[model samples]
Target: MTDEATQRLQDAEEHKKSYDGIMGAATEVGVPGALGLTMMFTSLVMANGVLLSILAGVAVYVLSHIIVKMFFSHH
Candidate 1:
């Protein structure tokens, strides 16, 4: 171990957080939003069709994207 180890630790602590761009923020919110809206539509007025199917696809994509971004973003 060297005397500069503490300095290295300090530098590591100062590292910047990962950037969540516009699309990233959108996915994180949009996935749940779509899922909720679908549920609401199903509950009220009682209608089902392509809207629900599309929301399902979006939900899956967003969730997988989030998982991949979370687990594989390390240096």
Candidate 2:
């Protein structure tokens, strides 16, 4: 009975590890997928002028980085 319990515990741990791996993979894939979709939408919306679109994108990106850094520094 002790041996059986040990085996069962090991099996449960292996399953937990596999579940964590799958969740990690899903998180990796989902982030890029969402980013790609958002980029596509932004491109379509700003399709009138490439220069303006690029400038706006860069401005937003820089501002976001600054904001994030500012908030992060407080911690």
Candidate 3:
């Protein structure tokens, strides 16, 4: 391969590695934080019942993971 092609490939690999590291870090911190926030929000907002609140909290947690993954996975 030419010098420019090799350089571009190296740059792409570096970028991918950086992105993976960032996503890994985000997952490490974001999950527990999201769970805690979901619990808090559910408790405060859905005072009507326990089951519904727990369900809402789970939904929030799942949504947070999805959002984080989608945001980080894309360029």
At residue 5, give the lDDT of candidate 2: 100
lDDT of each: 0.60, 0.62, 0.75
Q: Tell me how far candidate 1 lies from the true structure as C-alpha RMSD in angstroms.
A: 8.1
Better candidate by lDDT, 1 or 3: 3
- What are the runs in model 1 whose C-alpha is more than 4 Å off? 1-48
lDDT of 3 by residue, 4-61 (tens): 9999999999999998888797685677467857685768675757776777677777
- Ranking of all candidate structures by their lDDT, best first: 3, 2, 1
Q: What are the runs in model 2 whose C-alpha is more than 4 Å off?
A: 41-75
RMSD of 2: 6.2
Q: Write the per-residue lDDT of candidate 2 for residues 14-64, one digit (tens) a residue.
A: 999998788655544444445444554586586746666555555555555
Q: For model 3, what is the error of residue 64's alpha carbon versus the real structure, in angstroms, after optimal superposition?
A: 12
* Clash pairs (backbone) in predicted model 2: none
Pitting candidate 1 against candidate 2, the one with the higher TM-score is 2
Evaluated at residue 48, the lDDT of candidate 1 is 45
The residue pairs in collision within model 3 are none
lDDT of 1: 0.60
Better of 2 and 3 by TM-score: 3
Order the candidates by TM-score, highest first — what do you get?
3, 2, 1
